[model samples]
Target: MKAKVVALLCFLNLCWLLIGGGVFSALEWQHESAERVSFEDTRSRLLQNYSCLTEEEVTNFIRAIVTATNAGLTLDNSTASDTSNWDFGNSVFFSSTVISTIGYGHISPSTYGGQAFLVPYALIGIPLCGLMLNGIGENIGNFITKKKEQYKKRWSKKVSDRTAEVLVMLILFLLFLVFLVLIPSAIFLALEGWSYHISIYYSFVTLTTIGFGDYVPGQNSAQRVVYRLAILCWFMIGLSWMAVILNQVSTFLTDIGVKAQTAREERKKKKEGDVGEEGEENKAAEDEENWGSTKSAKQSNVELRNMTPIES
Candidate 1:
């Protein structure tokens, strides 16, 4: 039964992921289409006002701007310059995002070869990242379990195991919130000169792998290399922290469910046992009535037989 429940939960989770992905994709497409239409309208109005360039020239110029943005390049019109996308520091940052599944997507591969490589790279990298995070989470969970046990032994007092587990999980979660979210938000606020609220929003979004791309670090910063490296480190650690919290929560919920299942089975068995006892008692009472009836009939036959013998 526990296995069945776990399987059902997993199936539901997968379905949810698929549904969410589909909805978000559709919404994104609609948003992009609307933005494109609005942009064209604005461009037409501006062109009408200026009358300095033909429609074809303006269209070509807009296409060039879009192309440059897609390639992570800057336009100067004098010469083509190398994009920061392929730099060592930014490459490392991008790799971390891919493996972690954050995928901010502010920068993306423009070449067919790069795009082809990305699929296989993510396939291999995502699972590797998961394995690493799972290992870390398991180790931390084990350590906490050991400590709880030792504490109980030392105190020699009765403590609810569930309570202890919940407390430990809460502590771990608080620590993650402080270190991963709060501290990072403060640092980003200081370094990026963003408002505190926005910094917090960005940190949460990045750590949660939402990666909305509304705000990205190191885009125009002078310390691009250092900023990218720092962001990568922060996200990697945050991912592991989240993994640990999730593992603990999963384990905690599973344990509760198993206990509830066991209790249910016990109650069912007890009810079945009571029913069997009642059935046995009913059968015994019926046998007793039959025995009494048989004895009475025999006694009557004996009396009749004795009375008839004397006359004969």
Candidate 2:
């Protein structure tokens, strides 16, 4: 049963990954192709205008720029001072995301020393963050459980305990989504000037720690310390909330699997019991028939012996 459950979960995971990959590919492929074409056209125009610049030189320059940008250096002169990735406030933001394992990938260490330090930093910090989140998630789960009991009592006459628990969990999950996910997404929409869907997508991705870093918040804002701090706090609470919900889901699946295992065992035992009873009945009947046959044979022999002198 346990093996069956594991196999089912693995299958579902694979399906989810394939579906997600397909959807993302469909959504982004054409736009990426168009961007590539535009980039090539621009390169052609640049070379045409500047006869002295070679294609190799342009490529090298672009590569350098990309490498620097990926390493969190700001090339734009206007925003470099205020919005630098290494600024104290932004560094705090980076650290929090790293520890929580969100890892937005919007910024990263540019130096060998910093990269080496990050290995140990993440090793220590991720576990600590997990411990904190688990503690918080457990508390929240306990609180929901108490509420579920209350609701269960009210719903006892109408539904089974399992049904009532499901209802309560559904309600709780909705509440958490509304407050932690939907409302926050709305706020991000307003603050970051992102479309509604993009905001929601970003919120879900961040809370789930699937951070793609494609649409990070507070990137363009010059004075974004408060925004960054608020986002960090949101990450903690939202992550904990999601953890609690997922834990409940996992518990529910495990319960279903366990019940299935128990029922199959019971069925097997009942079948064995019935077969044993039938075998005993058959053995008893056979023994009785054998006894009767022996008695009849002895009686016949006795009668023959009694009549033997007259017959001879």
Best by TM-score: 2
Worst 10 residues of 1 by lDDT: 74-83
Candidate 1 at 224: error in angstroms?
A: 2.8
lDDT by residue for model 1 over 8-123, one digit each (tens)? Answer: 98999999999999999988999999999999899989899989888999889889888877766656553245445687887888888889888887788878998999999999
Scored by lDDT, model 1 comes in at 0.82
lDDT top scorer: 2
Q: For every model shown, what is its TM-score relative to the native structure?
A: 0.79, 0.91
Candidate 2 per-residue C-alpha lDDT over 224-286 given as tens digits, one digit per residue, 9 for 90 to 100: 998888898899989999998898888887787789889999999999999999999999999
lDDT of 1 at 255: 87
In angstroms, how far off is 112's CA in candidate 1?
A: 2.9
Pairs with steric clashes in candidate 1: none
Q: What is the Cα-based TM-score of model 2?
A: 0.91
Candidate 1 global TM-score? 0.79
